[model samples]
Target: MNKSKWLYFWGLLITVAIIVISCHHLPPSKSSVTIKLSGWGGSPVEQKLLKQVLQDFEVKHPNIKVKYEVISDQYMDVIKTRLIGEAAPDVFYLDALEAPFLMSQNVLEPLDNYITPEFDLADFEENLLNSFKYQKHIYGLPKDYSTLALFYNKKAFSKAGLDSPPNTWNELRSYSQQLTGKLNKYGFGESPELARQAYKIKAYGGKIVDKKGNATFASESGLKGLNLVIDQYQKERTSVLKSDVGASSGSDMFGQGKVSMVIEGNWAIPYLQETFPQIDFATAEVPTINNKKGTMVYTVAYVMNKQTKHKQAAWKLISYLTGKEGMEKWTGKGFALPTRKSVAEKLGYDQDNFRSALVAGVDYATPWQVGKYPAAIANNFDNQFISALLGEQPLNQAMLRAENNANQQIKMME
Candidate 1:
């Protein structure tokens, strides 16, 4: 009775211990994954908002974790370097300006396969979405965008005896004359960057680059539109650069009462409100040129690195962040304007008095992208266009030289 019973009891105890140890060693049914996301740093408020969004994303997708990092400075250069080394984050912000180059480099994952009909690709502003498309493949989804609009100081306009912002380029010029009263205050604030002036070039059928991707903004049509800027600065003497008024940007010039009107983007709204709350200002769609309406639209998109090891989790993160609900949160504070038409309507930004003008320009706005050599084209155009405005050279000659120089630089890069 004692020996057989003891052996049976020991066997049963050992079997139970083996089962417990095996269960402890077995993998769980669901494992958590961590994916890295990166973007250039924004304002502290924006960072806090992004953190909250990420927290919400984690709550919705508990099996996936996000590791967010800020590149802080030289965002694109750092991102490109990381991409070349195959050390980039699974997801990162890619400006439309840089998207053309990256999309052509085959380092980004084409998002077409992941995009389902339910994603509602149609809801994105077509032009904004097209900025991230190359060769019929969608490489990224736009997260936010901003469009140029006429930002006028309401008090300044009232003081000038003007009832409303100008509706045409001619009206703008005439209004400038009336608004320029004090020596310190100019009628219009001008930013002579290529991104700002590209639309003007397009106003008269000018192309920024030829089919070969060489700079070609010095043509007859180009000068026809650019000459308007030159005339306003050199001949009319009504417009002033921010530097002339000791301000950092067009928005600052308007905020400081150095200019009555300035063409700026949605970013200026919060900046003006926060930095110069005492000033009463309003935004209007940029006035028409050559009987055609136009403005510059800037956008940035979320793209996935082709080298990411966790593709499924990374796509989940990307899809959520750029999806309808997430975009609503990102743009709700109006730090940036929403890219999705539905989200914009939901946020009521399309009807916002300050933002509606920006939204209106979307239909006719030219994206601030010029093929894959924007940096070169922009540098040359800005350098020469300012010279033209300053009367250092005629507009035609300056643009011609700029086109030549930009093309030379592009050839070298090739």
Candidate 2:
């Protein structure tokens, strides 16, 4: 009720009002951002491991959240459609086989500008990293990869009195003949698809596609390499297709003791171990073709959308997922081999008995990308190549037909 007390109360009220107005006018604090990520469906275990990695990312970056989606089938088709509609995710998985087309489409964000020195761009394998590069701009970062290797059953080798895996094309044929009808119905299981045979085409200085994206694998050099496969299957009768053994895949036939040897990728390791635990097997670099070592390498990368509203956050997610720590966790279980040299060395894959051959082949392996239009080339080649393998036509005739048909389709696509 006194004058002095009333004055003090009024001053306190004015100070409180000034502070409230100042706080309201200041810039709002940074808010959390949600980035949408999409990828094709993987195995249950792989899905779980990825979820854990995302959770860790969220914890590390409290301001960012991730929304993940899985396109179960027709993944590339769905992604292309969504990209055209401008409704694609901020980040998505891009297979090296499909990278060329997308990288050239202008719909992908070049990560080169965003990549920092701490990211260690040089840590990636040159071949794998180059798969996602277009015009010297990096469009994506490879997360993992697999190179084909020769897998042979130890028990079957013992039965055939073969001490080790074949070292050359001729040796492989001789080994196949010695093991056929004694260890299993077929000594070697063959996949007649172009993906498995492209390296063979290259071993003899042949190319799968020209610079302009046309099929050209029917040349003399290409056939020279391919004849090795045809001779073993048609003339020697030591090799059999998966269908011949009533198996779904090469690994399946080998696991069931229907075949003694097979050429497959790293994926077969876990499948065989869990599917047929009792089957003892060892892996070796794919036997040399014409005295030149070669195999096919497959890889997938995490790419950013050019229209992303959250570029920084998306880059963070990609870098973390492909970084050394995250890659170690993802590849530690051996589902897929690491693409980074440091990660592979740290994991001891080079010393692993069953995985060493697969690791070693990365240096000389041919990547499984054949220019911008692969489906056309692969489908035509597969159909005609199978026809040849089944004795429906001559090898040269079948390859010529495939090459012509693939070029026509590629023209339409262009």
Specify the highest-lDDT model's number: 2
Candidate 1 overall Cα lDDT vs. reference? 0.91
- lDDT scores for all predictions? 0.91, 0.94
Model 1 clash tally, residue pairs: 0
Candidate 2 lDDT, 1-414, residue by residue in tens: 999999999999999999999999999988999999999988899999999989999999999999999999899999999999999999999999999999999999999999999989899999899899999999999999999999998888999899999999889999999999996888999999999999999999999999788999999999998898889999999999989979999999999989899999999999999999989999999999888999999999999999999999999999999999989988998999999999999999989998999999998899999999999999999999999988899989999999999999888888
> Model 2 — which ten-residue stretch has the worst lDDT?
178-187
Please, what are the lDDT tens digits per residue for candidate 1 over residues 60-165? Answer: 9999999999988899999999999999999999999888889989999999999999998999999899999889999999999999999888887877778988
Write down the lDDT that model 2 would get. Answer: 0.94
Error of 1 at 183 (Å): 10
TM-score of each: 0.94, 0.95
**Residue pairs in clash, model 2:** none
Report the Cα lDDT for residue 249, model 2. Answer: 97
